[model samples]
Target: MSLYDEVGGAAAIDAAVDGFYGKVLADPLLSPLFASMDMTAMRRKQKMFFAAVFKGEANGADGYMRSAHKRLVDDGLIGDAHFDAVALHLQATLEDLSVPGHLVRQIMTAAAGLRNAVLNR
Candidate 1:
């Protein structure tokens, strides 16, 4: 089965994204940067991200990196620490939901690839 099929598709990704942002916003270290925006849309984007990864494809996430954080990073509002916190939050959120081991590894590996694409500093 496709990893997306394995995890229950878009709905599962939605839950995971919601859980991740909840953890992030609740986190003292991570909440500040996200304070001004509605995280809902971002969570939707995250679900798309996960869905693509789980399906073993890359569909515009590269384009996303180009424009996605242009404003924030250009303003110097985000850096390595913030990225790491987000990664940690994602891991915890997935763990809390008991995502399967293989899927977890797939997500983590995909995240590592994106991390390279993300913070090019």
Candidate 2:
């Protein structure tokens, strides 16, 4: 089965997204970065991002990217440190859920690509 099938599609992705954001928001260093947005919107965008990722569809992710995180660096909300924290939290989340290492690596790699684009440091 493809990684997409292993991920259990949208329902699993939604659950994972919720769990991921819960971890992010609970971390003091990260929550403040999200203080300006409505949690509902964040949740929706996260679901969309995860859906695209696990479904092997990324073309539309740019819309969510633009809306959810385009200002991450510009607004001084995220930098290298924040990216590391996010990576750590996400890996822990996947580990906690017993997701396969391959799937986890895919997520980390994809996130790293975004991190490089934003941090550039």
Candidate 3:
């Protein structure tokens, strides 16, 4: 089963995204990066991104991730540490939602694989 379905599909992703942003916005290290972002748009994109990834239909995700963060990477606002922080927040969000540990690990592994793309390396 896809991770999206395994974790309860759209509803789960929605909750996870909301929970993730709640933590991220509260995090001093991560919050500043989103100071002027259009959160509604950001959240919408996140939902679409996660849905595509979890559904195994992320055809252009790598390129998308690279382009999406290119500016931040160029400005030095994004780096390994920031990526790790985001990953940690994602993991915590999944756990907080009571997702099974095995699935969480699977999801995290997939996320980790995107590190290079996200970091624009």
Which candidate ranks first by lDDT, i.e. highest? 3
Each model's backbone clash number: 0, 0, 0
Q: What is the lDDT of residue 65 in candidate 1?
A: 73
Model 1 ranges with Cα > 4 A deviation: none
lDDT of 1 by residue, 11-64 (tens): 888888888988988988778878887676777777777788788786877567
lDDT of 3 by residue, 1-121 (tens): 8878999999999999999999999999999999999999999999999999999999988899999999999999889999999999999999999999999999999899989999987
Give the residue spans of candidate 3 off by over 4 A. none
lDDT for each of the candidates? 0.78, 0.76, 0.94
lDDT per residue for candidate 2 within 33-102, as digits (tens), equals 8888798887887777676676677875545454556567677777778889988988888887778898
- Evaluated at residue 69, the lDDT of candidate 3 is 94
Sort the candidates on TM-score, descending order: 3, 1, 2
Q: What's the TM for model 2? A: 0.82
**Candidate 1 vs candidate 3, lDDT winner:** 3
